[model samples]
Target chain A: MSKSILFGKTLAELNEICKQIGLPGFAGKQIAQWLYQKEVYSIAEMTNLSLKSRELLAQKYEVGLEAPIKVQVSADGTKKYLFQAKAGNFIETAMMPDNDRKTVCVSSQVGCKMGCLFCMTARQGFQSNLTAGEILNQYRSISEWAEITNLVYMGMGEPFDNIDEVLKSLEILTSDWGYALSPKRITVSTIGIIPGMKTFLEKSNCHLAVSMHTPFEEERKKLMPIEQVYSLEEVIEHIRAFDFGLQRRVSFEYIMFKGVNDTPRHVKELIRLLNGLRCRINLIRFHPIPDSPLQGSDDETIMEFKDTLNRKGIITTLRASRGQDIYAACGLLSTKELVKKQEKDY
Target chain B: MQSLNPVLITDSQPIANKAFLLQFNRTFIFKPGQIIGITTQKEIAPRLYSICSTPNDATVSILYTIKEDGVLTPQLSALKAGETIWITQPQGKFLFDGKPSWWIATGTGIAPFYSMFQSGQKPLKLIHGGRTQNDLYFHQEFQALTDYIKCCSQDSGNGIYAGRLTKYIDEQESLPPHINYYLCGSAEMVVDVRNLLIKKGAEYHQIITEIYF
Candidate 1:
C-alpha cells in the first residue's frame, strides 16, 4: 500500500517504523513523543532512545525536519522563511511579530489551484499539498515560535483543498497529545471552498476569516476565479444559517484594488450583501506582485469604503499591511530563491 | 492541567444551511454560562469559529451555517465523521444566568445561545428577531428554553411575530425587576437592542452582550 505524504498514520504506522528499525512496538509511542511532544530536531538528540534503535531508524527514515534555509527581514518586523519542499519545490512561510501577539503565516501547498487573477502563487500555478510533517515544520522551525501566539493559513496554498493533512496537523496542534495550543489562536483563510467551508465550520472551532474581497460577483470574478464557481451571493446565503453570535468571530478579508472595486457603489453592495450578518470587514492593503494587472487601491478610497461600511452599522477596520519590503505582503509570498534555483536546474 | 473525560453533547442542524453540528470534548471543566475560545488548529490555521457549547453539558455542541462564496465556511463544510479539530478552554461573558432577561438576535447571530440554553439557566423571555424562517435558527431549543417572541423584520417567512426586536421590546408594557438583557448576533441588532433595553429602564450593566462582527 502506498503511504500518504503524512496523514492518517495510525499508531500502527509508528509501530511499523519502530519494528522495522529493530525496536519494540511500544517504542513507537516514544518516537511520537519525541517528534510531537519534545519536537526533537536531531535523532542524536533522542538520548532516551536505544542507540541501536536510533541508528536503525536513521538509516531509513530520517526525522524529516529541515531548518529554514533562507530568512528575509522586511522593514517592518515581518520575516519570511524559504524552504525547499521534498520534491525540490520552493515554498515561503512568513512570521509577523506584533505588539500583543506574534502570528506566523503557514502555507498549505507548494502553490495553489484557485488561480485568482491577482495572486502571485496562482500565477505560478498549483503544486502538491505540503505533507503534514512539512506543514508542522514551518511552525517548529520558525525563529519566533516562542513568541508566536497566532497562525494564519493565509499564506500560499488553499488550506481546504488539502483538508486531510491540514486537519491532521491541527490534531497535533490542539490535541493534548500534541503541541496543545488553544484552537482560539489559529485563523485560516480561504478563497471560498464551499464543501470545505462547511466541514471547517462544524469540525473546527477556530475563528473563521473569509477572503470576501468583493461582494459583487462580476467584479470579484475579475480578481478571484473561484467566484465563478461559488458566487458571493451564494456564500453570504450559506453563512446566514450558522450563528457567529459567540466568540467564534466571522471576519471578511477585503483587499482594496484601486478604483476598480473601491467605489461608493461597491460599499453599498458590500453593506447589502452583509446587511443581516454579524461579522467584521477587514480592509486590506493590496501588495502588487509581478506583472499583475491589478493596482492597489489608494488609501483615501479604502478609508472611504471603510467609513461607509462602519456608517452602515458594519464593524470595519483597516488591516495594517505587513512584510512589504521582503515581498511578504498579500500574494507577494513566492520565494525568489526557489525560483532562481529552478532556473539553474533547468 | 486538562482533564480527559470527553463527551459528545448537543449536535443538531439549526438551519437547513450547509453548516453542521459543532462537537466539543468535555475536557475543560465548564460551568453553565461560561464562554470559551475557539482557535485555529495547529495544522491549518483556518479562521476560528466560536461555538455555543459550554462545559456544563454531557457533550458540547453548536449550530453552524456554511458560507457559499466564503473562504472560511466553504472550507469548513468539508468535515467528516471522526475528524478532530481544535478548541480552547471555555471563556466568554455572554451566558444568561438565572435572571429575568431577553436575548435579541438576527441572522446566524443566534449561535451562541445553543450553548447558553444548555448551560442550564432559563430566562423569562427570549425576544428573537430575524428576516425569514430560514433566518430563525434554534426554534425548538428556544421554545423549550423560555417564552420566545419571534420578530420577522424583512418578512422572509409569515407567522412570525412581525416587526423589529427593538420595536417588540419597546411595545412591552412592563418588564421584570433585575432583568438582565443579553444581546448577540448582528452589530445593528446589538446597537438597536441596547438602545431599546435602555429605553425600557434596564441598567447598562443589566444589558450584557456578545457583539458579532
Candidate 2:
C-alpha cells in the first residue's frame, strides 16, 4: 500500500504521527518545518533529521507534492498550469501577473458538482475532491511561487462544497508553521452553500466572495442550481449575521450576461439585496461557452450597470478580462477534455 | 437554520434492489417537493433527502439507495423500527408550481417527483431513466399516466425505451417550448438533459434543476 502524505497534516496531526512512529514529540515540528516551511520535495532531503528517523518516516509517509505537468501561456502573460491530482484526475491553476501583484487561482476539486448553467467546469461533472496536499501543491509547484502575492479559490470547483479540505488548505496556508500567508491575501469563492459558508466564516478569517450573478430568486435558480437547495436570501442573511471585522473583506461576483441579468431591474434588486452589507461587487464580463444561450453584456451596458451600482452607494468595479485566449478567465477554467470518465453511483 | 429534531423510525422496508423506503411520523409541515435533513448522530453532518410521501400522509417517507461507502445511507438502511434518528424541518425551492411541466429524474432523484405526484400534482410528462427495468422505483404508481416514458439503458423490457435518457431526448424533433422542465438527478444527467433540451428549442429559463452534490 502507498504511504500517506505528511504535507497536509496539521501540527497536532504531525504530533500524533510522531507518537505512532516512536519519534520524539519535537520531531513533529521538525517534520512540519521540512514539509511546509522549507517545502521539501523528497523525504531524503530532510538532512537535519537522523537517518534512522528519516527512514522510518519514509516507510509510512511522504512529503507529497506533484509539480505541474503542463503549462499554457497566453500572449498577455497569463499562465494556466495543469497538475495531475493524486487520484490521477486533472486540475487547472492560473497565475495572473498584474503590475506588482501576482494572483494564483487554485482549484479545490477535480471537477465540480455545482452544475451552474454558465460554468465550463460544471460541464465536466464532478470527479473527486482534492486533498489539502493537492490543493496547496498548485501554489507550491508553480514557477511563480516565490512572487505570488495573492491567492484566490476561483479556479475550477466550488471551494465551499469541499469545505473540510478547503479549510485545511487555508489553515496550512495561514498557520505559522506552514506557508505563513496572511489571511487577508487569500479569498475563497463559493456559490453559496450555506452550511459550508457558515462553517468557513466561523473557522477561517479569509475573505469571502459569493457568485451572485442575478439578484432575482427565480432567475438565479435557472443559472445556478444551488439556489434550490440554499437560497440567495439565506446566504445573504447569514452574511448579514456574521461579524466580519474591518480587515476581512466580503465581495459579490456578478457575471454580466446580455439582456439576461444586466437589466435595470437586476441593478435595483442588487441594491436592495445588498443595501446594508459592507461589501464590494465585482462585475465580470461573461465569456461565451459552447452552445450557451447567454451572451456577455456589451461594454456600454456593463459600464452603465457599474455606474448605476456605484451611484446607488455600492462599490462596484468592472474586472478586467484576462487570459481569454487560453480559457483562464472567469467561468472558463475547465479540464473537461483531459478529464477521464469515472464510474458514477447515479 | 432550523435545528434537527429527534424522531423514531416507524418502519423501514426495501422497495427495490438496493433501494429502501424509510418512514417516521410527520412532525413538521413541508411542501411536497421540499427536502429534510437527516442524520444518525448529532455530530455528523446531515444529508438532505426529499420527502417522498404526500402532505396529507400521517408519516413522512424518504426514498434512498444504499451506497456502500456512503456515511449515512448504509446506517440508515440497517435501522429497525422504533430506533431514533434526527431530522430537520423540510426546506428547498424545488417545489412544483402546479403548471404544465415535464418531470425528469433518474435513480433516487425520483424522490421529489414522487412526492409531487403523490400530492396530486400530475405533470404533463414524466421521463424516468434507469439502468434496468427493476431500477424504476415507482413505475407502478406512474404507469397509469398517459405520458409516462421509461428509458432503460442496460436492460430491455416490454414497453421500455432501450437507450439512455439523453439519447431518447436527442432523438426528439423538438421539445415543447411553453412547458417548464424540472430535472432532479446527478450532475451529469442534469447538465446533459438541460443542454439537450436547449438544443431542441426549449428556453433555458424554462428549465429548473436540483443536482445531487
Candidate 3:
C-alpha cells in the first residue's frame, strides 16, 4: 500500500501523527508550514525537519498531491482539468476566470448521487468521496493556483455529501497554519442533505450554496431526488434558524429550465419561501444535456425572472454561461470519460 | 445530532439471504414511507432504514441486509428481541400519493413500497428486482397487487423475468409519460432506470427517486 498522505492533515491531526512518531508536537506546525505554505513536492524537500525526522516521515508518509491527468481550455479562457481519483475514477475541476476574479470550482466526490434532472454528473452515478487532500489538490495543483481568488464547491458531487473532507479542505484553506485564506472566499454547495448541510453550517465559516432548482416540493422532487429526503422547506427552516453572521452568506442556485420552473408562480413562491432570509439567488442558464427532457429558458425569460426577483427586493444575479464548448457543465466532461457498460441485476 | 430514544425490539428474524427483519416497539405516528435511523449505541451513527410496516402497525418493522464489513449491521443483527436499540425520529417523505404509478425497487429497497402497500396506497404496478428467488422479499404480500413483476437475475420459474429491471424497462416499447414513476434503490439503479424511462418517452418530471446514499 502507498504510504499515508501527510498533505491533507489538519494541524491537530499532524500534531497527533508527530507525537506518535517521537517528534516534538511543535514539529507538526513546522510540517504544516512546509506542506501547505511552502507547497513542497516531496517530504525530502521539507528541509527544516531534522534528517532523522525526515527519514522517519518519508518512510511512512508522502506529500500525496497528484496533478491533473488532462486539461481542456475553453474559448473563453475557462480551463477544466480532470484528476484521477481513487480507483480508476476521474473528477473534473474548472477554473473560471472573469475580469479581475479567478474562481476554482472543486468537486467533493468522484461522481455524484444527487440525481438532479439538469445535472450531467448523476449519469455516472456515485463513484466515491474524495479526501480532503484530493479536494485541496484541485486548488493547489492547477497551474493558476496562485491566481485563484475564490473557491466554490460546485464542480461535480455535492460538497456536503462529503462533509468531513470538505470541512477539512476548508480548514486547510482558511487556517493560519494552512493557506491562511479568508473564509469569505470559499463557498460549499449542496443539493440539500440536511445532516451534512447542518454540520457544514455549524462547523465551518464558509458560505453555503444550495441547489434549489424549483420552489415547489412536488416539482423539486422530480428535479432533485434529495427533496424527498431533505425537503427544501426543512432546509430553509434550518437555515433560517442558524446564525450565519453578517459576513457569512447563504445563496440559492436556481437553474432556469425553460417553461419548467421559469414562471411568475415560481418567483412568487421563491420570495415567499425565502421571505425575510438575508440571501441572494444566482440564476443560472441551464446547459442542455443528452436525452434531457427540459430546455434552458430563453434569455428573455431568464432576465424577466431575475428582474422580477430583484423587483421584489430579493437580490438576484444572472450567472453567465462559461466554457459551453468544453463541456463546461460540471458532470459533462467526467461523464464522457466514463466507460459505459450494460447494467446487471442487483 | 438526532435525539435517539431507546426502544425494545419485538421480533428479530432472518428474512432473505443475509437479510433480517427487525421489529421494534412503535412510539410515534409517522407516514408509511418515512424512515428511521437505528443503532446499537447512540455514540455510533445510526444507519437509516425504510420502515416496511404500515403507519398504524403495532410495531415499526425495518428490513436490512447485513453488510459483512459494516459498522452498525453486525451489532444490529446480533441483538435479540428484548435487546434495546436506539432510533431517531421517523424521517423522510418518500411518500406514495395514492396516485396511479409504478413503484420500482431492488433488494431491501422494497421496504418503502411495502410500507405504502400495507398502508393501502397501491401503485398501479410494483416492479421489484433481486438477485435470486429468496431476494424477492415480501413477494407473497406484494402478490396481492394486480400488477407485480419480479425481475430476478439468478433465478428462473415462478413468474420471474430472467434479467435485471433495467433490461426489462429498456425492452418496454413505451412507458406512460404522464403517470409517476417512483424509483427506490441504489443510486446507480435509479439513474439507469430513470434514464431508460426518459429514453422510452416518460417525462423526466414524472420520475421521483429515493436514493440510499
How many Å off is the CA of B193 in candidate 3? 1.2
DockQ of each: 0.01, 0.66, 0.69
Put down candidate 1 lDDT per residue, B18-134, tens digits, no spaces: 646666556667554444333223344333234566655556665556657554455445544455555545543344566667766666566666566766656677777765555
lDDT of 3 by residue, A1-346 (tens): 6799998899999999999988877899999999899969998898988999999888899998899999999999999999987666788999999999999999999878877777889888888888899999999999999989999999889887778898899999999999999999999888888888888888889999999989999899888888888889999999999999999999999999988999999999999999999999999998889988889999999999999999999999999999998998888998898765535446
Instruction: Give one digit per residue, the lDDT tens place, for model 1 in A198-271.
Output: 77777777777889887776566445645534566766776788776577877899888886779888888888
Candidate 2 C-alpha lDDT tens digits along A1-346: 9999888888889999989999888898888888888857888998888899899999999888888888889888999988876456678999999999999999998778889999888877777888888889899989899899999999888898899999999998999988899999999999999889999999999999999999999999999999999999999999999999999999999999999999999999999999999999999999899899999999999999999999999999998888888988533545544545565432
Q: Model 3 segments beyond 4 Å from truth?
A: A340-345, B68-70, B176-178
Instruction: Quantify all predictions' global Cα lDDT against the true fold.
Output: 0.66, 0.89, 0.89
For candidate 3, give fnat to 2 decimals: 0.65
Error of 2 at A107 (Å): 0.6
Task: State which candidate, 1 or 3, has the greater TM-score.
Answer: 3
Query: If ranked by DockQ, best first, what sequence of candidates would result?
Result: 3, 2, 1
RMSD of each candidate relative to the true structure: 18.7, 1.5, 1.8
Judge candidate 2 at residue B11 and give its lDDT.
99
